[model samples]
Target: MKQTALKRWFNSGGPGVWLSAGAVSIAVIMTIGLLAVIAVRGLGHFWPSDVIAAQYDVPGQESHVLVGELVQSEQVPRARLKGAGLPVPDQGPEFMTRDLFKIGNRDISPGDFSWVIGEWLKDQRKPAQLMTLERREWGNFYGYLVNVKEDGNVIAQGEAAWPQLQARIERVQGISDQLDRLEKGEIGAINHGIERLRLRARKLELDGKLDAAAQADMASERAEFDARYKAVESQLAALHADFNRDSLTARDGNGKEIEIGIGKVVHAYQPNAMGTMTKLGFYFQKLWEFLSDDPREANTEGGIFPAIFGTVMMTLIMAVIVTPFGVLAAVYLREYARQGVMTRLIRIAVNNLAGVPAIVYGVFGLGFFVYVLGGSLDRLFFPEALPAPTFGTPGLLWASLTLALLAVPVVIVATEEGLARIPLTLREGSLALGATKAETLWKIVLPMASPAMMTGLILAVARAAGEVAPLMLVGVVKMAPSLPLDGNYPYLHLDQKIMHLGFHIYDVGFQSPNVEAARPLVYATALLLVLVIALLNLSAVTIRNRLRDKYKAFED
Candidate 1:
């Protein structure tokens, strides 16, 4: 009776349903697990880890002390360690443990990370005075405070040096901020004005319209800009002199002391001495810096604000470009075009376009959009900027257009499906009420189909946000000096190269010279990209759900 019941349950499709459910559950669990791993690896990088000072005595190597954060530890087969040219003890078990240390001071050391056999580490202790110096260049410095100086003379040393160093650093930072403003803001504007005057003169000369009056006016404008530039330059020089006056000397574990400019240090903290509250505050501070600051150290350190801005802006542009075109095309095919051979072939082609390799789209975009269309635009509208390429270069505009082309088919298919689901009686009813086909589509049909459009937009955003290959060919760059949208006139500069998170991840993960240093950044960037896509999709999904709710009665 039990066997018969079980067989009957299977025959009734219960087993199939349960099996499908189990498969979906497993898939969901795997995805969650992957994201969890990424989060742990990425978010943990910013935390203030306790610095460990270890005495090492390895055979065939110099006995010395090492100090830094103990980044990771893993057990490997004894044979593997031997194969890798490490001296593994044969008396031990078949496996041996190894620890990776982030021994910073990259300016002094051969590298920032080193792997040591766990057995060779004799005495490991967390030294309270060990300081971690986060710098703007050459990664980080792990050391102890020696002295604080001004004008090459030691003003404070030993314990007093720490507080003096902090005070001077704050003053130096203020000076640095002033220098940045003078250089990038006031000075930058003056330089831009001078360039405009020069261009104006060139244009007038080209048109044979340069008279004495025009020349005098241009000269006066140039003179004004030059005066402003000189004043800003003088201020900058003074700020730099002041900023460079304060310096600090630090001694590493090897007792070698190096003097670093106060301006070069981003932050210095004694991780081992820090209490839980201090570490928490430091962690959140680092996290905020990562999200808000511009990247330094060859895109390996600092914040990814530019990449984040570029990504969000590009996706928004692509959506704006794709939606109207996709909706119009779908409406024409479904409501206007007659059902025949040509229409059927067109439908097949649209479906196939969705499956086409994304790289192929990138190539087509490079050839047609960047080369042909953009070149023509530059020649016609920006003739003075010739040879510099201007619009004829890979930029945000072309990138957005390329992605729009790549994503339009998805939108079309989705909108068409929505239109098809709308019953025939509604259309007939609208027509009987003296509504034209265009009117019906614009008012009734499109409104009901809006939910599907939003669905397509969500899919497009998800796909486009993660895309790196096509963006490389179109507009994305390793580093953009200025963001596409900035305080400059015509603030939204379409013909500007952008830093994208997807491309940033690719560059850091694969192309970076320092692989170990870039690895954690890769995970962090990947997590941020995923979050960006999720937020974008969630927004679209919310709008879609609302539309679906409002339009459900019409469908019924």
Candidate 2:
């Protein structure tokens, strides 16, 4: 009876159903686990970690004191350390534990990180007096505040120097912000205007239309821009002077004293002295900075706002370009054109295109879009910018177009499927109501297929957002001097190269010189990318659900 019941269950497909459910559940759990790991590793990086002052005693070497944040710990075989040419003491079984420390002060130390054996560390203490300096360059500095100086003279010493240094840093930061605004906003505008004038003069010269009046107008505009530039430059000079007026003297664990300009310091805080509330506030502040600020220090130490902006802009552009073409093609094939062997062959071709490697599309885009089409555009309309290659270069527009081409087949297939699923009676009924085929398709058929179109778009966006290989070939760069969209005329400059999160991850993970420092940033960027893709997909899914609900009666 038990064997008969088991056989019946198997024959009823219960076992298969259970296996499928199990597989799906495992996949969901793994995805959630992966995201959790990434979040923990990435988000934890922003929290201020206490610095440990400890003495290290290795065999056959003089004892020395070390100060820095303990980043990680691990256990490894003692033979591994010996193989790596490190003197491993005979203790702690065949494997020994080790701690990795981020001993900042890259300016003084030979390296930023150090790994010490567990048996070597002694007298470890979290000293509240130890200050951590987040610098604009050279990673970070961990030391003791000695004094504060202004204009080459000591203004405050000992504990009093801390508050004085904070005040001076605030003043310097204010000046720095002003300087940034002047440089990137007003000064940038003036410089752009001056370039436009120069280009206009060149265009006139090429056309043999440089009359005296035109020359006078051009000269006047140039002079006005030059005057504005000088004024901004003078203001910038004064700001720099004030910004550099203050400095700080600090001593490291090795008692090596160094003087750092206050302008170079981004923040100075004693983590060991910070209360839980203070640490929480600092954590959120750092997280915000990571999200909003431009990257600095070889793309390792700062935020990724530009990358995020570029990614969303490129994906939106791709969607705009792909939708119409894909929809029209699908409409003609499935609605208007008679189905036959030719139609089947075309569908086969499109399915095959979807399977084509993305990098192949990138190569084609470079050759066709940037070189052939963009070069022709430059020669015809922008002759003055020739040789400099405005559109005839890898940029945001080309990247968008490339990704659009890569995603079009998916959209076409989806729209066709949606169209095929709609009842023929609906179209006939609309036509029977004295409606033309065009009107019937637009009003009755396409509306029913809108949900599918959104589904296709969601898929396209998910694929495009994480694509790195193709973009690197077509448009992505290590660093973009300015964003593609800005306050300049033609506000969206599509011909500018852009940074992308995918490439940023690849660069930081594999290409960075300081791998340990860049590791957490890689996780952070990956997490952000996942979140962006989720948000984008959620938006499309919402629209799709609404459309499906509105048209559910027709499907039924």
Candidate 3:
């Protein structure tokens, strides 16, 4: 009875009539729930960028809690002292920074970047036995520093002897004092004069019953002087601050280990060298400074504008390139070409091309464009720009071209479908009125198919904007110091390196020297890329939908 009733209920019509619907619904619900959790946690990690000051053990002089003697590298040179046949030394172990690599299980791989610096952290009045991240701990970190090309080379096994921090600080302070004298003499006087002038001007401006022309002239002069004064004052203030060292700060926390924030922060450690990866080690404070600061160092430090600019520019170039070729191919196939085996073959080829791996396109682009064309052009036209390479190195133009190839199929398919959907009578009517084939195509078929063309373009833009692999093979730089297009003599230097957010993501996550510092930024850049792609799609979709609606009544 129960079985029959259950079967009947399962077989019932409407909502009751179901097979695998419950399973599907449950699966979907679970999928959505999981995604929601990941998004919430992942996204939250990228926000609230604050940089707090932290100090390590005063350089050189360190306390050892393990025993009365200072803990040195010889104390426990390797994590597994017995296995290495190197027992923890009886004398205070003098440690090396790279030695951290031998310490088992403390891999910063998933976390990304290295934040080890050899310094002192004053935790309370007592010199807390803080593990210095860089100098002292670097020896331990060397094992991990071993990369694909070099093993045991990047890291030194033994402790490196260097002048103590106390000595270095004294020398630095001596120079700093001399610099301070110059500031006090020249800078202080200049600032004082400007302040006096400002006060005088304010008083004069407020003086009543002056002639209109005199008033106008005075106001203009005062404004100009004020602007110049402010600019100089700002620079002076910055100079003053740079010379001053920050005092130690203390705070009471809820004993809560703060959740590390992930977001974009831009700084350049290396000024010269193309494709040099400047992975500035992460600091909690660095993150906050980046968010609130404007770009400097030729728009390098404290700003991610260059990376953001490259991403936008590359996407635009890709879209412009792909849209025309894609739509044209689509138009020819749908409107001009006759339906036959040849057309079918072409369509099949296009569909197949779309499925080809994006990375493969990168390889093809590098060979054909960078090596073949770039080399040929360099020889013929730009012989002067020879060894440096005008178009040889993988850069912006190649990246854009690579992306365009990837997007072409999308545009072609969308446009072809749109063209097919147009009413036959529209074309026939135009032809019947003695309009030429070209005229009919331009005035009738194209207008009707535009929505589809727009749709294709939008899709292409979204896909190309966040592409990384093809860009890797092409012209995306890890750190493009100067953008491709700048206010230089030529204005548009096509051969120059360009940055991309997608590449930025890879660099911050994998290539940064300061992985701990860059983690939050990696997440932020990913989120930004997603938002940007969505925005591109949204804008394109809005236009396409509007065009579709406008033509809907004609179709009806």
Candidate 4:
């Protein structure tokens, strides 16, 4: 009876159902685990970690104080330590524990990090006065604050200097904001205007229209631009003078004093003194900076706003380009075209195109879209910018178009399937009610299929947003501090190169000179990229759900 029952269950496909469920459950668990690991590694980076001030007592070597955050620790083979010429005892256990410390002061040391055997670290303590100075250059400074100076005169020293330094930093920050506005905003616009005038003059000269009157007009424009630039330059000089007025002296672990200009420091914090609430606030602040500020330290520090902006802008442009064309092709295939061998072949080709390698599309876009199409457009339209090649370059437009082409086949297949699902009786009824074939499609067929179109779009966006390979060949760069869209006359500059989150991850993870420092950033960027894709997909899914609800009556 038991054997018969087991055979009956197998015949009912119960085992296959259970196996499929188990597979799905395992996938979900693995995905969650991966995300959790990424979050812990990346998000923990912003949390202010207690700086360890410890004595390093190596056998037969003088002891020295080591100061910095305890970055990580691991047990390694003693043989590995011996290979590195470290004084590991030959009689000790085969595996020895090692700690990696971020002893920032890269200007003083060859590197900002050091590896020390765990056993050699003596008198490990977290001093409340230990300071961590986040700097714009040379990574970070781990030391003790000595004094605050103004105009080479000591303004505040001892315990009084910390508060004074904090106040001065706040004041400098306000001044810095003003300076940034003048530099990147007003001065940037002035420079852009000057370039445009120069380009205009060049265009006239190329067209054989640079007569005396034209020259005079161009010269007048150039003079006005120069006058504006000079005025801004004066303002910038004043700001710079104020920016460098204050400096702070700090003492390192060896009690050596070094003076750093206040302008160079981004932030100063004593992690050991910070309460949990204080650390939480500081963490959120750093997280905000990571999202909003421009990257520094070879793309290992600061925010990834440019990358986030580029990824969203490119995905949006790709969606706009792919949608109508994809829908049209699907309409033609499922509604208008004759059901013949040629039509079948066309469908087959499109389905196969969907499976083509993404990098292949990148190559095609570079060769056809950029070199051929863009070059032709540049020559025909921007003749004066010939040698420079305005559109005949790898940029945002080419990247978007490449992604659009790569994604269009998915849209076509999805939309065609949606159309095929629509009952023929609805189309016949629409026609019987005096609607033409085009009208029937436009009002009846397309409306009901809008949900499926959105389904395809969600998939396309999910794929395109995370794509790094094709973007690298087309437009994405390691650093594009200046965004593509700015306050210029043509606000949206599609021809400019852009920074993308996906490419940022690959660059920081693989190509960075500071491997250990950039490691956490890789995880953080990967997590952000996943969130961005999810957000994009969620938006499309919301729209799809709305459309499905709105047209539910027709489907029933």
Candidate 5:
């Protein structure tokens, strides 16, 4: 009876249903697990970790003090440690515990990180007075504060020095903000004006209209810009002098006293002295900085604001370009085109295009869009900027166009399916009620299909935002300190190169010089990228659902 019942269940497709459910459950579990791992590794980096000061007693090496946060711990085979020339005793356990410490002070130390065998670390402690200096250069400085100085004169020492140092840092920060505004705002505008004047002169020369009057006018503009720049430069000079006026002395783990300029120190904190609430506030502050600041230290540190901006801007531009084109193509194929052998072939071709490798699109975009179309546009319209290759270079516009082309197939297929789903009676009834074919499509058919168009866009955005390969060839750069969109004339600079989060991940994870420093950033950046794509898709999905609900009565 049991065998007969099992056979009956198999024939009823019960096994297949259970197997499918199990597969979906496993996939969901795996995705959640991966996200959890990325969150823990990436988000934990911002927390104010207590700094450990320890005595190192490695065999055959002189004993010294080590200071920094404990970065990671691992178990390694003793044989591997011995092969690496660490004096590991082979008579004990097969595996030995190893701890990696972030021993910052890269300018003075051999490296920023060190690995010490667990058994050899002595007198490990987190002292409340131990200080960690987040710097503008050389990674970080881990030590004890000695005194604060103004110019060459010592003003505060010992416990009093900490508050004095903090006050000076705040003052320097204000000055730094002012200097940044002057340089990037005032000076930058003047420099841009001068360049524009120069370009105008070149264009006149090319047009054979470079008379004495034009030259005089160009020169006058150039001189005006120079005068403004001079004024801004003077302000900048004074700010710089003030910025460099104060300094602080700190004693390192090796008892060497080093003086760091106030302008160069970004943050100074005693992690061991921080309360739970203080640490939480500090964590949020660091996280915000990471999201808002430009990258430093060869993309190993700082924020990824540019990457975030570029990714969103590019994806949005691609959507704007692709939606109408994709929808139009789908309309022609499904609504107007004669149902013949050619129609079926075109549909097949589009479906296959969706499966093409993204790198192929990148190559095509570089060759055709950047070199051919962009070069022609530059020559005809921007002859003054020849050889500099304005539009002919890899930039934001080309990247967006490339991604649009790559995503068009998905949109076309989705819209076609939506169009096909609408009952023929609707179109017939619209025509019977005195509506033309065009009117039927516009008033009766298109609105119902809007939901499907959005579904296609959601898919396209999800795919395009995470695409790194094609963008790398077309526009994405390792460093783009100057954003494509700025306060310059013709504000949205589509021809300017921009950073992208996808390429940032690739560069930081694979191309960074500091592997240990880049690892956590990679995870953090990956998580951010995921969140960005999710947000984009979520917006599209919301629109699609609303459209679907609005047109539901028609379908019902």
Candidate 6:
């Protein structure tokens, strides 16, 4: 091929040469331009210098300014803090618990403080009060550690906030209730087992000469039984102290009862995670954290961890489910089966399946897996668990299986091409050396085709991660309280509901009641997913290219 190509190159001074050269040059230029544009836009998300910080205040009155020091305080002036009698700070640092500031707490939502510093400077009103100083920062006013409460020299404090009298009262009641239950013999004491064991030991001691090992075993059992009984007793005491009666009852200031109705406290608040963040500064420090964090009723500790987990799990499961079946099928077709009418028909069918719309698979999965198969299992195995679900519920397993079916054709096609690419001489030589057909197929063919198989897997992952409609039919919940796997009894709970990044982006952008606020997150999530898929493809392509290079010398 090299000699022929060299000969042709020397002979060719015609339109074909010029056309190919022009095409290559054009492609190179276009690719460079595209990369430059994407780099400018995508990397721009991380540059910190261009942050447009703003805060909100009264329209007419001049807002207070912080000229030299940026004050960070939860306390607004008593006059400005109250809104319609509620203690809502108008423009100040939000009150946050230590836990709320972490990367994990999705329950916390970001608040709005939109007034401009320039407004505070021009306005005759007092400056933005300095509350808390992070450290002794003298350069740029990063944030403030101390608020206007200048009276106390010791500003930073984390003292014990003693429990109120009512809380103590509740703890006493909780303990009393347990004591009453014990008195009434509503629950048997764990020590009854110890008493029985002691009586048994006494009887056995009189009648038998036990061996040393037997005596040690008996002692060990006694120790274990005693430990368990003590553990239960300790748990009862701890629960009484930890959750007072008030802990059971939810309430807010003013003694207003707080009841999270069936849907009332469905946490889906995505504040800063949403909204158009034109302020480029917001992106550099907190942008990625905000997007990948677990969801909140509002986007306070914005981390899209759940969404990332869901997307990765679904795609991985889809790959696991699809790869073997598709690759095996291709292997059999290429290695074992001879050319026949059936083979041609199967090929056509596989192609047709590949061409089928993704939504149809979603519907099929919903009907067959969720409705028929799941419904049947629910009735048979989990009749007692009716109304609630077991395997009969639409969830993670079904979603992955559905996507696997959808991805099978891609894997099959890639594997088939790979199988075809292997030279027939390699197979014949192996067989001639007395290697069995199965051995040749497995040892010689599959390893050679691995790179191509990986390419198929990459494409499959990309498709599966972006899928929304099919997952919607199955177990993709908008807000899964727990992940697919957890510290629960059954760690890998396939039946559990899962949050997906693809569907999450859709829900935030389109389905959210607060679409205006949620739109920015949609872009951010979309961008992250794109980056992930591209990385996956890139890795696969690198492997495929290396494989191709290695195999090049072996070909005819």
Winner by lDDT: 5
Model 6 lDDT on a 0 to 1 scale: 0.59
- Give the backbone clash total of model 5: 0
lDDT (10s digit) by residue, model 2, range 1-556 = 9999999999999999999999999999999999999999999999999999999989889998899999999998998998988877666588888999999899999889998887789999999999999999998999899999999999999989999988888888788889888988998899889878888988999999999999999989889998998888899889889988899999998789999999999999999999999999999999999999889988998899989999999999999999999999999998777889999999999999999988899899999999999999999989987679889999999999999999999999999889988899998999999999999998999999999999889988988889988899778998874788879998899989999999999998998889999999999999999999999999999999999999999879
Write one digit per residue (lDDT tens) for candidate 3, span 90-203. 454344232111121123223212223222222422112211211111211111111111111221111221122223334434545555444554454445455544544444
Writing each residue's lDDT as its tens digit, candidate 4 over 1-556 gives 9999999999999999999999999999999999999999999999999999999999989999999899899999999998999887888888988999999998888998998998899899999999999998899999999999999999999999999999888888888999989988999898889888888988998889999999998889889988998998999899899999999999999898999999988899999999999999999999999999999998999899999999999999999999999999999999889999999999999999989999999999999999999999999988887789888999999999999999999999999999999999999999999999989999899999999999889888988888888888888899999988889978898899999999999999999999999999999999999999999999999999999999999989
What's each prediction's TM-score? Answer: 0.96, 0.98, 0.56, 0.98, 0.98, 0.57
Residue-level lDDT for 290 in candidate 5: 95
Worst 10 residues of 4 by lDDT: 382-391
Q: lDDT (0-100) at residue 480 of candidate 1?
A: 86
- C-alpha lDDT values of all predictions: 0.90, 0.92, 0.57, 0.93, 0.94, 0.59
- List clashing residue pairs in candidate 5: none
Model 5, 177-212: lDDT tens digits are 998888888987888888888898889998899999
Which pairs clash (backbone N, Cα, C closer than 3 Å) in model 2? Answer: none
For candidate 4, what is the TM-score? 0.98
Candidate 1 vs 6: which has more lDDT? 1
Q: What value does the lDDT take at residue 444 in candidate 6?
A: 85
lDDT of 1 by residue, 154-210 (tens): 999999988898798779878877877777789767876776677778778877999
Worst ten-residue run, lDDT, model 1? 481-490
Question: Candidate 4 at residue 438, lDDT?
Answer: 88
